[model samples]
Target chain A: MVLEATLRGIRLVGDRTLRIVERIGATVAFLVMTLVHSATSFRRFDLVIREIFFAGVQSLIIILVSGLFVGMVLGLQGHETLQNYGSEQSVGVLVALSLVRELGPVVAALLFASRAGSAITAEIGLMKATEQLSAMEMMAINPIARVVAPRFWGGVISMPLLAMLFSAMGIIGGFLVAVVLIGVDDGAFWSQMQAAVDFRHDIVNGIIKSLVFGVAVSAIATFEGYEAPPTAEGVSGATTRTVVSSSLAILALDLVLTAFMLKGWN
Target chain B: MERSTLNLWVGVFVLLGFFAFLVLAFKVGNLSAGGNGTTYTLIAHFDNIGQLKERAPVRSAGVLVGRVKSVRFDPVHYNAEVQMAIDTKFPFPKDTSASVLTSGILGEQYIGLDAGGDEKMLKDGDEIKLVQGAVVLERLIGQFLFNKAQDSGADKGAQK
Candidate 1:
């Protein structure tokens, strides 16, 4: 009897796992459909513009502050390490390289996912819980185009811009810490940075990484919100899931993209 | 926000982003969108390139005059051929000697030019005859260790 019970328990767990996987597959397919439909119906572009403002412009301040602090921290740490080897003057190169190549995109994406992505999820979840999505569906309008598509496009378009701003702020922050605070020669700092970082290699790759993360985080947020159980607790749960999952996705995508993009860069 | 106002802010935001991108590319990445302004090419041959790379600064009297345009190996001469683009404004003599130098102990390699007292200037497609190859640190360390071993061996032989 115990052996039969153990087998039954194993079968139940396997079935549950398959159901979760199937749900995820369905969500991804729906997201792709929404994206395609939104792309085709471009007449209501004002909605997209509004979303750009909400998702992109609204999150600018936090991204800048985080970028500035991160850059300063990197500069301080890089200075201490480089000073031991008498190569402190190359701190600018070190800071610019690290920010432009890795931290700028990854950190900015994490912040973006936390700030704007959560807001997106909450907004959509509330709309669903309050029956607005159902009302739109009853009225024969596709909620995906009217609701999710604009936000998705907004996130995608804004990601690279936010990432660029973050990196620029970071460069300036590093300058302040390395040059003004540490007394490294201003000329050496700028010159070495200019010489070492490559336009196509570092800058373009970083932008691409941010763009990919933007698509992923926004898709996850929208999917979770759209599919959340239509209840108060469900909305809050979706919001939490948006933040947690998007952050993890950003980190995971960053690793895969970095591995592909940064090959032969050394 | 009104549609017009929103459009304006969006425009401004995009402009700022583009401007920042330009700064990153041109200022930080050392890529210039402008044409190579009135430059001439000069070639130098080196025995070994070591860590020399294309776009390495070519400096004269501690001032940057040009950059390495390209680097290739001349199979016939069994040497590395480096093409440099010197700014026309900072022309040097035909007999100027170029030597590969390191910025610091663990820094990048660059070409340093010592201008000679020649009246004529180096023109386009001219080859700099006097060229010194890069100083490889590993080779230097190996030579130092070899010499120390030889000296110790000689001292032991004398004692015997």
Candidate 2:
């Protein structure tokens, strides 16, 4: 009996592994389908605009407030560490580069995943659970084009802009804390930052990173929702999966992108 | 939400994003003062470039006038060949000397251009004749140590 139980356990693990691989393959196909359908929304335009309002504008407050706090914390901590080395002057460069190169895109994307990503998943999941998607299909409407593609493109449009704004606000916050409160020289702060931060390498890479994250998060959200079983519990589970998988995807993609972009420096 | 209101909000959001982008580019990241407009390339060869790198500032009289465009090994001459993009506005005479320099003890290496009294301005692809290579701190320290050891030896001979 013990031997039989061990074999059962091995089978269970193997089943789950295959299930996960299946899900990943489905998600990639869904991504391609979404992209092909996206061209339809361009003619409509309003469909995409409405999604931009929901995904981009609605999430603005949380992104801005979090950006400010993160920057303030960076300034305070950077000051504490850099002063010991008598290089407090570089606090500006430190704060700016960190925010631009890594923090801005990463933190903003994580927040977007939890905020807008989960929302997209839940909204579509509920539509599926309530048979709204099936009704659209019956009405001769292509739900993928009419509903899903606009949301996908909306996220792609908004994520990079949001990340840029977050970095900008973070810089301002850093300036206020480091120069105004901590008494570091203002000129040194700005000048050193200007000298060190290259626009092409740091800022452009940040934009590209956010754009990629937007695509991943939106694709996962929409795919999970579209594939969700027509039940309340299924919808909820898919929503949870959207958050978990997209967060993991964002981090993994970031590592790959950073390694690829860093090759140009030398 | 009202139809006009939604459009207005998205418009504002897009505008704000581009505005933030401008701030990052111009105020924070040196976009305004970045290399643009017309520039002329000048070549200089050195024995040892030390840590001088591409995009290192080319300064004349402590003012940034250009940037290092490229650095390569000159196999024929057995040295380093550096190409610099000098701004067209601040033209240098053909006889100008270029030297590799450092800032603040151990800071980054850059090119220091000292102008000459020649009437002709440097043209694009012109070669700078006088070039000073980077100063290697290890070599300076080694020379100082050798001089001290030699002096001590001479003092020992005198005592004997």
Q: Model 1 fnat?
A: 0.58
lDDT of 1 at A239: 89
**Please, what are the lDDT tens digits per residue for candidate 1 over residues A93-207?**
9989999988888888888888999899889999999999999999998889889998898888888988888898888899999999889999999988986787877899999
Q: What is the Cα-based lDDT of residue B138 in candidate 1?
A: 85
**TM-scores of the candidates in the order shown:** 0.76, 0.93
lDDT for each residue of candidate 1 in B37-154, tens digit (9 for 90 to 100)? 5679999999998889987888899887888999999999999999999888888898999999998777778999999999999999999999999888789999999999999999
Q: In terms of lDDT, which candidate is strongest? A: 2
Give the lDDT of residue A50 in candidate 2: 97
Candidate 1: misplaced stretches above 4 Å?
A: A1-28, A180-183, A264-266, B1-12, B32-47, B52-100, B111-133, B137-160
User: In candidate 1 chain A, where is summed lDDT lowest over 10 consecutive residues?
Assistant: A33-42
Q: Which of the CAPRI classes, incorrect, acceptable, medium or high, describes model 2?
A: medium
DockQ values of all predictions: 0.45, 0.75
lDDT of 1 at A107: 88
